[model samples]
Target: MPSPVGHALGGAIAAVLIAPRGTPTGSGSRLMALRARLSHPLVRLGALAGCLPDADFLWGRHNMETHSVGAALAAALVAGLALRSRRAALVTGLAWLTHVAFDWLGSDDTPPLGVMALWPFDDRFVFAHAYLFEAISRRYWLPNFVTHNAWAVTSEVLMLAPILAVLVWWRQRGAGPRV
Candidate 1:
């Protein structure tokens, strides 16, 4: 599956696309606008959600319950209650789902072969077989491990960077009233 970096990027992209725009009235520097967007509570929560599925790794369950839609819903509900905002909950849930989406599009070299994305509904694992992102290696002792993972990260950046650039451009260009 894709590395945490890719998952985090996916989450950020989801936030950029789904979270309501909060650009302040009047004009501002592109960097400041981007900063404001990134620092929004919903966006930060979305980014956190993106990497949360991997927390299962701490318990030796990498792609099981935590990677499921059920878990995403649960998370969303909890976030909604805590934040008192349905949109925040939705953004968080979608950001979490981006983790599953990235895993589905990535190569998985380990056993079990795919993510249990439909866990509560169906215990079956699912994989896209698209191989858009390279599988990340956990074997840190291997000599080539660093280089292999570096290439994987580079590929992820290549794929995600353009989307981020476009988001920044769109936000900046649309920050002011259009008339």
Candidate 2:
């Protein structure tokens, strides 16, 4: 939600994974095509627009659902409806979900009320906000919303492999049309 890293990671995964599912014969090609579509200024603007509102409009106390999952889904759904691409919808959903998932693990609070991460299907929202960012001194506050948690250290040391792998696979699999 803060840096868009989680959203980008999730979008990449969903795009690559869904590409193959949508067109089994041309999985890579579909991925590339979708990537191109996603990269468009219109699509990027749309995604950012969807994501930025919560950060801009919402108040403090960590609006997890609106900031992460809710916003992402709203963006994806809008983009999907506007573009008429189910794949686009899928990718956007994944992006939003990914943002939520990351926050869940990084913190200790449960999700906010009525988050509806899987809206129209699931009614529950996650509300975990345990991570609190401190400066390098571990005493002072950072400029923006950077949280410090035990899991942050763990995430840096151990969990990075799978995350990196997923990222690498997403980008590589989504690149170029195969002959």
Query: Which candidate tops lDDT?
Result: 1
- Candidate 1 lowest-lDDT run of ten: 170-179
Clashes, model 2: 13
lDDT of 2 by residue, 99-164 (tens): 555444443323353233544454465544544211112334654324553434434434333653
| Cα-based TM-score, every candidate | 0.90, 0.47
107 in model 1: Cα distance from truth in Å? 0.7
**Per-model lDDT:** 0.82, 0.46
- lDDT tens readout by residue for model 1, 1-179: 88878888888877777665546444387677777777767667878899999999899988999999999999889988998988878878999999988898899998787899998999889988999899998899999899999999999989987886677566545542231
**Candidate 1 regions off by >4 Å?**
25-27, 172-179
- What is the alpha-carbon lDDT of model 2 when measured against the actual structure? 0.46
Candidate that scores best on TM-score:
1
